[model samples]
Target chain A: MTDSSQVYVREVGPRDGLQHEQTWLDTADKLNWIEQLGEAGLTYIEITSFVSPSWIPALADADEVARTLKKSPGVTYAALVPNRKGLERALLANIDEVAIFLSASETHNQKNINADTESALARLSRVAEEARQSGKAVRGYLSMAFGCPYEGKVEVDEVERLAERLFEMGVTELSLGDTIGIAGPKQIEAVISRLGRMIPLERLALHPHNTYGTGLANIYAAFQLGIRRFDGSTGGIGGCPYARGASGNVATEDLVYLMQTLGAKTGNDLVRLTSSAQWIEKRLGRPLPSSQLQLSKEEGRCL
Target chain B: MTDSSQVYVREVGPRDGLQHEQTWLDTADKLNWIEQLGEAGLTYIEITSFVSPSWIPALADADEVARTLKKSPGVTYAALVPNRKGLERALLANIDEVAIFLSASETHNQKNINADTESALARLSRVAEEARQSGKAVRGYLSMAFGCPYEGKVEVDEVERLAERLFEMGVTELSLGDTIGIAGPKQIEAVISRLGRMIPLERLALHPHNTYGTGLANIYAAFQLGIRRFDGSTGGIGGCPYARGASGNVATEDLVYLMQTLGAKTGNDLVRLTSSAQWIEKRLGRPLPSSQLQLSKEEGRCL
Candidate 1:
């Protein structure tokens, strides 16, 4: 990004990355990767969520992972906190930002927090407001905002109403979630255009899964629409804990590759990113769910 | 499409789909699939190729497969023919159309056909002229027109020049290739926009491989630009043989999914298409690569 108005990539490996890790990441390895990502020039990093340990045992050392890292001066670290209990734990970690997630789909909300959409929104609003009182910036994640694999097509009005309510509740930003990676450019345009009317562009971020492998293309659509913040995972970490057969979050390396090519400023080394991804691939006992990572490693192959 | 314009979907599974399979399809299975796809309202079914048996013995049953099927009256059964030898063989079969392929990159052309771009063009032109003289509509396959796996970024002028030359060679239509599948919407626009300027949109089509999984999105861009004809395989069948690690062609069912969702008309039945995909998936010992196929089988999922 040569322009002063550049995009920021929020690295979600620490939280989204380890959530689905079959093999628990040793605290040392977690801290090591966190430190590396910090040095790699990520302006925003999501360290870990303060969700229940039983739900995500992989992130049990969330507080330790947060405290062990040497903070990159200008970088902000955020964590996902479900409600008051999760927020208390995140507050103890002294994180710069916290995120509250609520679903646009009623079923997802019912399953997510065991509350209906209305109740989930009320609880999320309270959490965001209370977190604001403590002077911590809160981001509201509206999951299944585009289309849920569970519920099929989610209404844009439902997404917009929730986003407006979140913004009113003192949340710093609204991140639209395409949980199952079913969104395309047209859908992105439709949802974002509607949300852009309801919410401020600066207050909007996007979290797109690469399930259908359209993550990068969807990001381009958002970029064209002047969206400057996006959520990505290192090595495409973090499979959906709730959704079955869903792809991981958009690969950080692929995001960087597309952004850098399209003139978005992200100070990530392609070679190092691919190597780190390869390391994660080995740990996961599978190929990285990143087309860019695989394409990069095929040495001497022209494309 | 609500417009008077119509889109033609060419099924390339028989030729492109089975080319990489080591397991030679039962001649009966091949014939059954061709018949099934024809019933699905495919306008142009690429039945088989007349390549050397030594190179692609999996498709050695092409002659038998072509002669045995019940040809749908309005549907064109096209065959891939690389040179004079392949063309002669295809002409002897029940082939309604013959497609000649020439690579855009000199390196790809040399590696793929042991001929440079010019020589390969000359050979294809000669074959196209011969097929036209025999009253067969000749479709030209311009491989790697977007990007070559063997030679990175292909030039638009070169692609446009070759496409124009192919038109002059008595070709019926052109299918621009995304052989390596590195193309995004902007690149798709650049190619079609340039080609649309040189040649009429009526004679243009897109043949995208899903290596990077942007095939559907690229197809969306193509449709948006008023270029309707496309090539896809059942169950996302074939990958570029030379481009190791690259993905197979986009699945016909998945393409139909995108087209139908956009409110375009296609004569394919999703349920039956899904079943056919599953049948091939069992034979290939892998799940179908189409996103919609997997999503469909999941109890709660929909695309």
Candidate 2:
């Protein structure tokens, strides 16, 4: 087993965060933020999503964002691809990895993607095969794996079934998302315990939102259960699509601060990350929802 | 060992929270909120502090608050008393329990109370004896037990020694406070492991601030280590007196939501507690910092 002392942090601000913003960030600005994230020693940066712009207008320049960003040699630049068409676009943009997402609940999957759970899985299976053949890494996101705002209390068996299928489809990693941020410590432990038995812990990642303020608690629980990789937005800019007016992804600064404080080797610089978060928040003309960023900005110090 | 499935929550919003607010809540309103908290099934509430108005003008009406609030049969109402004078005031107000506080670090103690650590301990020792003789349950708070804002990392041995001293001084419970909220999982585990050897876990409680957003994480860590009791503010209205521009104590709504989600029987109604939080926030004219309150208000649903 890999030691829990090291954590892999994946930054998903550009795709998950900006997509929820009402004001559109220019492609150049998105690329600038991506470059800043890479410079801060983030090994994985989900640059943008190649989904239809009609579905998420804020990320209309996804192709431009993926093509224009400066990629660090050590950083893996990723993009979210909703379908085979999006996968083709990601390949054209020279993305290092493509993430495909489907919610575990039938209602959530239908509401989010306009497809049922089985249809979404079949579609993702084909996309994963195509991406693998292109020599690109594939990541599967099981959104609402913990609970769904629409359905509520997704079962662990459902998550295991979906995750096993994704793994079989050649996904290098499976990101279990608490899409609405309703998961607590015991719920996280139960889900991870069941999933860990069927999937390798190294290939399992946690993607928790902070809507109900249980994000860090759930993350800590998962870490104790041997989950090492985590996905976070730089400034908690994203939103839970199902739970309107709730928070976005857990803040990258908060996650990095917690991991680093616990002696977990993240290889990310807290000061530099905070600076980047401040820079982006300034551009957005609104404060990010990150508690650590707010504290660092107010105190003029970093973790 | 006690079952980890049960959690005892201590609500300190009236004392810890209101004292930090710039706008004062009327004594009647404070009593109303306390009544609501008790109605929601909270068994313990720290009603008010017996500090002088010169120090914390917000709680100047503490006597009225403690005397006017309706004490439920099953609920234990507590008060914070800094010295023998404060302890006398608490007894005069008919408080069931009196809490005495001193920081684990000399600098924090000096800054917060105008006394060195040893002198503050000596003063608290006297107050603890008086309160115990009065047949009042006494709780000792060691502030900055996890880390200090000025001194930085506080040694665990220092915390253990202070906790041992407090226990020996007739304190029924010793609340270890992460006053600055800089503690992480490993640090919490290390401190709790060392403290658990000398003090019974039942006599130990966690009082963590959310300054760096690690409050819930620390609470979960302590809970896993068999520390069942936790202290929280209703609306996250309290501030770390030492850590400038930081968040207050972990929100009671957030903590209750987490414990309930984990199947820990707190016996508190989250909906009723959130209603009280909303009522207080409305009076303050600004939103409280509790993320759970925000979600509950936005979603119009409580855990």
Candidate 3:
């Protein structure tokens, strides 16, 4: 089981949040936003993706983002690397951490990265090895671990098998992404309990989207089951571009408020986090879907 | 712990959902809305408040609303009764159940009902007795059980003492209201654990507001601790009139989606419930905050 005394929230706003939007923020705006998030007391951030710019034009300036981030002391900046090429780019940018991705469902894996489950893991295994040899921490993301838009009701055993393989391949952490947010507390408990038998709970993190409004509840269920690390986006940005009407990742302020109120030590300051969410939402020219940010601003309370 | 296999969702759209709104729904609209809710498979519904018209002019048509209801079989239709006078009105309207309200915090009690804590309980005690004599189910609500807007954090012992008094006063069910939505899972666990020792789990229910976006999380926490009954409003209507930016009860669709997805039988049809939410939201002439309702309409999925 993971540590019960503390929780680490990895802010994925710059990468996960920005990737799904129709609008794009230039490199300068991205830099300013990332700096604000860095100052907001995030201990770990998924800063950008090193995948081909042609694929993710929104984060096309991944190299610039990695190099320009005024690396905050004690904060780990991680970037997603699809393969050896992306890993080399990350190495050039001097990234703190590199992440590789696969999926529990074969259909989702093929649809997401144009590879079968085995082929995707094979690619990530090589990348993970090279990234570890290069001395950068490696994180693995198992997308659609709960349910897939292409394949509904992902099996817990499949997730466990994939997770074990990722851990064996030198991934320091495995983030289970509920890509379409179809997870409920019961399913979360069942999945985490099954995975805990194969992997140390501390090496697992949960990244839930709020599609059915069960994101926070699912996260809380995981927390109670002793998973400490969580992935959230500021202002609740980034829905699954593949799933219709899927909302963004659970809002950072909402998660922070729940964790803080439950007496969990999250180090991140709520006031500063809200300001950063507000700033980004303004830049997006629309209101973000964060309830805590809205309440904290409208009510003027220090929640 | 409460039973995990089955959950009861008591819809409070006509009462709690509409009470805080600036716009008023006439008796005909209220009747139509309540009928829609009843037909949508809700086993329990809080129809209206039978308080003095001056106190809650929004629900001033309580008598007419109660009289016109089609009265679905096997459904418990309830109304809020502030005192003996209100109970008498409910009795005349042949309400299936009558609910009484008090506050765990004296300041909130005074501000909300213009009575001190002890005085409000005294009044409710008489109403509970009268309703019991008339063979009507009685529910007692303890507002601000988690926190109070006027007086910050409320003590667990204070809530325990209040719940005990309400249960002793012949209230069939006791609802602990997170009036300001300041509750976290730890506080919910602490409070429910203490109350569980004094009262049966079946007699206890949770009424959470989504002010801090902890509403569903709190409900999930309570559900994990064996609470089987919950109170929610359609389309997540109404905010706390006393607390700034305090949202309505956790939306019925959100709660239904969660419990149903968790494999707990709610006996409420998700598709029909969502249509009711959309219908009422249209009546209100604005978007309601229910993520489930919004997603169902936009995604065209039968959640």
DockQ of 3: 0.43
Give the distance in Å from residue B169's predicted Cα in candidate 2 to where it truly belongs.
1.4
Candidates sorted by DockQ, best first: 2, 3, 1
In model 2, which regions exceed 4 Å deviation?
A1-4, A240-245, A299-303, B1-4, B240-246, B299-303
TM-score, each model?
A: 0.90, 0.95, 0.95
lDDT of 1 by residue, A23-137 (tens): 7778888777777777777878888999889988999988887777778898898999988998888888888999988888988887767899888778887788878889999
lDDT of 2 by residue, A44-68 (tens): 9998889899988988898888787
Q: Docking quality tier of candidate 1?
A: acceptable
**DockQ of all candidate complexes:** 0.27, 0.45, 0.43
Model 3: per-residue Cα lDDT over A73-168, one tens digit each: 998999999999999999999999998888898987777788899988888889999998989889999988998777798988889889989989
How well does candidate 1 score on lDDT at residue B121?
Answer: 79
Ranking by TM-score: 2, 3, 1
Q: Cα miss at B276, model 1 (Å)? A: 2.3
Clashing pairs for model 3 are B2-B226
Looking at model 2, residue B193 earns an lDDT score of: 94
Query: Residue-wise lDDT of candidate 1 within B1-303, one digit each (tens)?
Result: 235345678899888888877566788888888888877777789988888888789888777777777888888898998888888878788589998888889898888778888888788878888888888889998889988766688899889888888889988789898877778777888899998886878788899987765677678778878888888988888854444344578888878877765667777776777677777777767544665555555554322
Q: Cα lDDT for residue B171, model 2? A: 91
